[model samples]
Target: MSTPSYHPAAVALQAVLALANETEREVADRLGLNLTDYRALSTLSQSGPMTVGNLAVKLGATAATTTAIVSRLQSRGYAERLRGEGDRRHVHVSATAAASRDIMNLMRPLMDATNRHLESLPAAQQDAVAGFLHTARHLMQNHLNTLSTKDTA
Candidate 1:
């Protein structure tokens, strides 16, 4: 067997992702939500109201599963389904005000601390960090696209 070498940046990125997942888990726990529900609520809050189908796609969940998730959210007073004004059959899922408030309250401390850390860096270092993260996000999206294409093909 051959040993495989890993890049330091790749290792660091993996650590960052693990930390993010842990944070998300803690947030979800405090909200009395499962991870999926927390993620769905977060998506709705950030993206505004969207069709259940669109939300399913974003969440990489089946339509039926998405409907169930929405139901759970609605029951918890974290989300609601709204009918389109013009189309009676069309419905959108939205995060309730309470969901946004609770999620923000849970996250504000972390957000403030992260912002402070970024602000403490020199301007050039701040820009460099921002640029690195932006590029990394783009690269990850591209990789996801490639994998999706391969799966479909």
Candidate 2:
């Protein structure tokens, strides 16, 4: 009988996520942001305007939950929901200038510190590690697809 081949990619992805999430949670606590709000703000910060459905997908959350978060951000003047330029039925969310500045300020130190940690690794190692992580993310998408399919079943 042949034994199953061990998959290091999955292990590495999990380990990296665990470490990153732990560090991010600590930073988030200090920033006084809940994880969900942090993730939503991050999504908008990175991807620019997004529909609630898209934001939910980015945050791994439900549409209803995303709506609540969006509402809160709007009340805080951190984000605004606008009628889609092309389609009024579809709403798009955009971060206000203040929100953008806030997110950048909060993230700069974390990004800089993380970069410093990565700088200790050899250039070749950095590329190799990044390659592995890229592959891991692609592979993880398949896992997500499976879950979506299962939900339909």
Which portions of model 1 show Cα errors greater than 4 Å?
Answer: none
For model 2, name the residue pairs that clash.
Answer: none
Task: Identify the leading candidate in terms of TM-score.
Answer: 1
Clashing residue pairs, candidate 1?
Answer: none
lDDT of each: 0.95, 0.82
What TM-score does structure 2 among the candidates reach? 0.71
Error (Å) of candidate 2 at residue 110 is: 3.4
TM-score, cand. 1 vs. native: 0.90
Shift in Å, residue 73, candidate 1: 0.4
lDDT for model 1: 0.95
The residue-by-residue lDDT of candidate 2 on 40-148, one tens digit each, is: 8767878899899999988878999999999987887878998976878988998888888877786788789979988999999899988977887887789899998
Q: Write model 1 residue lDDT over 1-153, tens digit each, in one string.
A: 997889998889989989999999999999999999999999999999999999999998999999999999999999999999999899999999989999999899989999999999999999999999999999999999999889989
Q: How do all models score by TM-score?
A: 0.90, 0.71
